[model samples]
Target: MISAVVFDMAGTTIDDRGAVYRALRSAVEDAGAPVADADLQRWMGTDKEEAITALLELGGVQPTPSIVSATFRAFRATLDDLYRADPPVPMAGVEAALADLRARGVRVALTTGFDEPVVGSLLASLGWTVGRGPAHTVDAVVTTSDVRAGRPAPYMIHHAMELLGVEDVHQVLAAGDTVVDVRAARNAGVVAVGVCTGALSRAELEAEPHDHVLDGVADVPALLAGREARVGVA
Candidate 1:
């Protein structure tokens, strides 16, 4: 039986693209570098440092610490502005699913590629502060900072499971909207469920090694309930 669910914040639980892209474009522009749309989407689910560095490399520019920092700061500021102006909304059915899971005694943990402050701000602006029902109230929040590395490494999911006192990765279901998310879950030996709300195409996600692909977060509750009932009935 799965006792907990680990969610990828941006694309999985929320649309997750607005603030980050807004921030990235502004940051790149501010740093006097041209930001390409494809590059940004390609780097989703990656940490700020890695994504910016990759972006620079793709543009045939050397990734300098100073330039990266400047772009990151600009991106952060823009994201903050976007959140304040109009926060990203939760994907349809996300709230009900989260509530149903919790009511069933399932622990929830939000895992993200974002840093601490930005995640906090976004959640706050969206009225999703910890314990704010129907959307928030996760048992824990795990950011890239909480792990040794981000997605495709399994460190983040491993760290979250440890923090949540879960011993078996199989008891955790990791859900996200990117291939990296699926890779991370697989690396940690957990069940990986992919959603198409983010950049990756449904075909792309299906081609990957994910255990399951969900149309949206709305299907999670039914998925879990069905699995649980199947186990019990058997």
Candidate 2:
């Protein structure tokens, strides 16, 4: 049985209106190293710094510290501005799904490739604070700053598992709307659920190996038996 759930933020839970990508694309272009549209899409769900560096490498340029810093600073400023103008909304059915999961005694942890400041802003917008106590909406919030590496590396998922006191990976179910999300879950030896409510499409998500691919977060609870009448059923 899955006792804990790990979900990715942004596309996974909250809807940021593609602000992250816009920031990255703008920053890269401003840096005089525009990323190809396909490249940018491929790098989704990764640490911004990592993605920038990868883009640089793909462009046959070395990821100098100066270039990385400048690009990252630009990206952050752009994202902050976009978010300030309009705070993100939660993906359809996210809140209800989260509530249902919690009602089933399942602990929820939200993980993201974003660093502390970015994640903090999102949480604040949603009236969620960082803490492990029951008073918190989510059990925990794990960011890239909390790990040595981000998605596709499994460190983010592992960091969440560690903080949530989950020793066995199999007891966890992870969901996201990116390739790296599913890869990270599988890497951690847990259930990989692909949710196409945000970034990717069903066809793109199906290209990767996943345990279950659902339309949105709303269907998650039913799939997990959160909505089932366990007491009366045989």
Candidate 3:
């Protein structure tokens, strides 16, 4: 039986692609550098500083604290705009599924490529107070700052599992909307469930070692139940 469920926030639990893109573009543009949507997409799930460094290198410009700070400020502004205009909407069944999991005694955790401050801010805007809403309500949350590297590194997932006191990888289910997420789960030896709600495609996700793929987050419970039944059958 699965003891805990770990989730990726950006594209998995909440839809923030537009905000992310807008913020990233504003930052890049503030540096007087041109940015394209394709390039922005490539930077997803990556560390912001790293992305800035890469962007600087590509532009043949040296990275400076001012540049990085500008980018961050712009990104934050975009995020704030998005929240004020349209606070994130929890994926269908996510609220229900989380409640069900709790009812079933399954512990829940969250792992994201985002930094803690950003994650905290985003969750708060969505009414995810620690003792209240579905945002800060998880048992554990591992962010980029808490781990050695971002997704595809497995450090975040490992940290979350550790926080949750889960020793067996098979007892945990990892879900996300990107290939990096699935790859992270696989690297950590957990069940990786991919969703299409993010920028990645089903074909791209399947190219990795994910254990399961769903149309969206709504199918997680059913997938878990099916996996349990299969385990019993075996």
On TM-score, the candidate that comes out on top is 2
Against the reference, the lDDT scores of all candidates come to: 0.81, 0.86, 0.76
Q: In model 1, what is the error at residue 28, expressed in angstroms?
A: 2.9
RMSD of each: 2.3, 2.3, 2.6
Off by over 4 Å in 2: 132-134, 226-234
Worst 10 residues of 3 by lDDT: 128-137
Better of 1 and 2 by lDDT: 2
Model 2 residue pairs with clashes: none
Task: Give me candidate 2's TM-score against the actual structure.
Answer: 0.93
Order candidates by lDDT, high to low.
2, 1, 3
Q: Which portions of model 1 miss their true places by more than 4 Å?
A: 29-38, 131-136
**Which ranking of candidates, highest TM-score first?**
2, 1, 3
Stretch of 10 with least lDDT, candidate 1:
128-137
> How high is the lDDT of residue 110 in model 2?
93
Residue 231, candidate 3: how far off, in angstroms? 1.4
Per-residue lDDT of model 1, residues 28-129, tens digit only: 756666778877776778787788777777776677998788777777877777776766889888877888888887878888889998788767766665
TM-scores, each model vs. reference: 0.91, 0.93, 0.88
User: What is the per-residue lDDT of model 3 for residues 1-234, given as tens digits with 9 covering 90 to 100?
Assistant: 898888888788777645676766677777777776566666666666667666655655667887777767777777678777877777777777777676666778877766888888887766654422334456777788887778778888888878888899989889988766787888888888999888888997788787888888778888878878999999
